[model samples]
Target chain A: MHVSAILTVIGRDRPGLTQALADVVAETGGNWGDSQLARLGGHYVGSVLVELPAGGLPALEQALRCLPDDLTVTLVEVTPEPHPPEGSRFSVSLVGQDRQGILREVTSVLAEMGVNIESLETGLEHEAWTGQKLFRADVQIFVPASLPLEVVADALEHISGEIMVDINLSEALR
Target chain B: MHVSAILTVIGRDRPGLTQALADVVAETGGNWGDSQLARLGGHYVGSVLVELPAGGLPALEQALRCLPDDLTVTLVEVTPEPHPPEGSRFSVSLVGQDRQGILREVTSVLAEMGVNIESLETGLEHEAWTGQKLFRADVQIFVPASLPLEVVADALEHISGEIMVDINLSEALR
Candidate 1:
């Protein structure tokens, strides 16, 4: 039986990092499925999905832990879940002057509203004219079918003004 | 001498599409540099950077144009620009009910303030409880050294109410 797993890795950026990881996966009879890898702040970070024979996971984990260059690897066995039924998917975006607790507050609201973040990317950019740093985030979230859009929007709207940030929520385009 | 070029391709999603493009690039002696490729809304779209011997651009373009599978290709020569000097980077995020002109209005403000957008991603999502469609956007912008943070933040803050969307701007984490 085939089993799926997620491998997360982080280390100082270097050449051949991907190849090194791939070599281990291959040796363990694992097939690379999908990955998101990037270098940020001189560090290489990535998460990859791998499929392998059910019995090979332990060996795969051991091999991954032994990779060179001080790379750290974490493995999680994943049971593929059934495809989710059709439901509402929304995109949430926020930007504000860099401050502490923005994510905490925003996520708290999401949690209270029962929104599940599917994917989120956050980064900072400078204002062209002012040179002021700004925090920005793009998020894809799944909303349950039972909630009212107004409630979620209203909840975010209520806090946005107080936080001095702009918030926009919309249905994800198909 | 080496020249850099960008290839933007779009076609119906299918296997072997990347291989076909790689084959053409290889035949033209182009070296793949980097790419962002994804399947979205049943279409395969990708932008790739390639390095080639200075004289091979025309042949590369010609070969790409003739690719099968109804693929569309556009090629542009890219002159690498020097990295911008260290300046503040900011993140901008926005969300509102899906509507026309949100981008136009928001971007207009940025342009008027002389902010430069480094990256922008936009999408729609449905509210989980309400099923209301929301429009969302995330943007990375470069702030010039001369502008004050308040000027940009205040500008967006002024419009958030009128636009019925939330907008936040913050300094990006280094």
Candidate 2:
């Protein structure tokens, strides 16, 4: 039976970084799945999903350990993901002036509500007209079946007016 | 005055792909802005926004020309991106069974209505139960002020029920 594992790697954004990782996967008889790799802060950061025979797990790790210097790798075997309670998905957006603790404040709210974040992408840019730094994020989340959609909406409504940001919350389409 | 240009590159996913580009930018006195770099189909695909002194534009392009082969690059100067008509930003998602031309059909509607796509990310996965292929995408877009949000909604409404896909559209928070 094939097992899956999550592998994350960080290194200088140089040529052959991905290929070196891919080589490990290939040599281990692993199949690389969906991966999100990008350059952040001038370094290469990536997480890959790989499936392989159970025995290949240790070999993959051993090979990763021998990869040349200056690279960091983390591998977590998914002994089968802990399937969350059946829940609804949510798509939320937050945009506002750049300030400290915005992510902390917002994520705190979601955590308080027992929501799980699935994916989040954020960016900071200068507003064209005023040159004010703008912070924006798009997040996809999962709300456990116990939470009501209206409850989430109420929570957002309560916080949106108090913050310096505009928040959009919706039951993301399935 | 500093001007901005968009640089896109595609090449084998190896070490130094991004650094090579950064080298050119640095050699020409260009400041790299935001860039999205990812691996797709076993190759590196990326687009970068860069700001550089007006004089550095030609030199930047010239240095790019001297780069080794196997890398394809496209540079476009944004004489200030044609300010789109006053409009709103939209976050749209389409998810359903994997099928050919799903992007074509959905993008056709947006294009026909003159909506400009800002960024799009998509993925395909296999359903755990039925082994069916699931396709999903998230798109960020700009709609000209001329188009009403409802018009876009209506267009989506018209298509959602006809296809095997479920779509979610919201005026992205800004």
Candidate 3:
């Protein structure tokens, strides 16, 4: 049986860093699958996914521990796992002037509706031109297949209108 | 011109939460594009993205401020920013044994390769039978079009083998 893993590595930025790390993975008989690497605050940050022979972790760990002084490696085993549930999906976003007491009222409604949130990202920015403060949030929700999309949209719209915020719903992207 | 914002509200969790927030957004004539709301640590946490008509914030703020008690709202402005230059898009992932240092090493190599990691997610699970760990990372990157995919894969593979991990590279599903 094959064992799976994901590894994340970080260190001071420099040359030969990748080659050095690759050397370890290559020698371990692991296959490199995916990655993302970037420089943040003058340091390198990377994440990757890999697979190993069922009983290869001991040897793999031994090899990783031998990394050069400047490099460090941590391995994460990837258990072949079940997937997320499937359902109808929708998204809603809201933005307005900065204040208090907004999130509580909105989320309570969704929870009551039994909506499953898939992903949510939020951020704040002050407009350079207008010098105005603004707030924003994007949320993706998984609606049960049996639910009516229009009804959900209408309910959300009612909530948005009541809150003086905007509401829109759509099928999940991707 | 319309102004857009993302709002995040977090406070002790209770009933009638989201509705209070949504009422404010709706009253402000903002369009709620998406949202995410949940409970964390006895506190209700929610985020919403809203698009408002020009000059509608003042009323929106007033409406939000009047929401039923015990909930607070903080608005954040969101920018629909474009991806950065050096214009390359790719995804990468790794699966391997759970350990420290893997993220550090892999990121170091990617930075050396001039890759920009856009988003990353990692998960770890322990095997009940063996007590071994499985690690997985999913990542998206913006690479220089000049960089060859095979070379990238080879470098990642080299590192994976050295670290005794697995890696996969592609345009998506990393």
Candidate 4:
């Protein structure tokens, strides 16, 4: 039987890195699946899903370990869940001047409301004219049906005012 | 003394593609700035910002043309704008069963309202239990200060009903 696994790889960026990983997976009879790989700050970081015969995992792991250039690989077994839990998906965004604790404060409120963050992307950018630093975040969250959007909005609005930043919460498309 | 340029590259997925591009830029006296690069469907695609002395641009272009494999590179000149126009930034999102004309219809409304889409990301996913295809989009937009948020929200709400989708519009955090 085939089993699913999550493989995370990280190393200094270099040429032929992806090919090396693919070569190992192919040799081990692992079928590559969904992955998000990127070069950040001169480091290659990625998470990949793979399907392989249950018996071949150890060999795959061993082969992956043999990759050159100090690449670190971690493998974890995963079971596919066919159904997503019932919840309303929403998108939350925050943008303001650079400051510490923005994520902490916002996520704290989310945690209090029993919200789960599914995906989040954050970055720092400069304002077009002033060239002032700006912190921006986009997050996808799952809100339990028991909680109302207004409750979440009110709580966030309260924080937004204190932080002097803009906070937007809306139902996610999908 | 320096000019900014946007470079976009797309090619078959392989190792060392980023390194290759970086080498060319470095040799051309370009300082890499911000970049977003990703692998999608066996293809590598990326956009990068570079700052370089004006005279180095021609050499950079020449070096990029010599990259191994058929990677396509396009460079466009960008001037740093000091100030954003007088407008409010907003987030607009829509989610519903996969259907045709959703983008066309929604964008048409924005156009009529004199709204500009700054960035947009859209995707399709399957429903958890039913496996139905769902289409979703998240957009960051600029609405002239003269136009109120309620106006944009109302226009989208009207289309949401006709398309049987959920739509939300709110001032973006900024």
Q: Model-by-model lDDT, in order?
A: 0.68, 0.69, 0.62, 0.68
Each model's number of backbone clashes?
62, 9, 136, 6
Give the runs in model 2 whose Cα sits over 4 Å from its true position: B1-174
Question: What C-alpha lDDT, on a 0 to 100 scale, does residue B15 get in candidate 1?
Answer: 36
Candidates 2 and 3: which is better by lDDT?
A: 2
DockQ of each: 0.02, 0.03, 0.07, 0.02
User: Which window of ten consecutive residues has the lowest lDDT sum in model 4 chain B?
Assistant: B37-46
For candidate 4, the per-residue lDDT at A109 reads 72
Ranking by DockQ: 3, 2, 4, 1
For residue A65, model 1's alpha carbon misses the true position, in angstroms, by: 2.5
DockQ of 4: 0.02
lDDT of 4 by residue, B70-141 (tens): 676766555444355587778887788865445556766787777766555555679999999887777667
- lDDT, model 4, position A126: 97
Candidate No. with top DockQ: 3
The residue-level lDDT of candidate 3 at B53 comes to 84
3 or 4, greater by TM-score: 4
lDDT of 2 at B144: 82
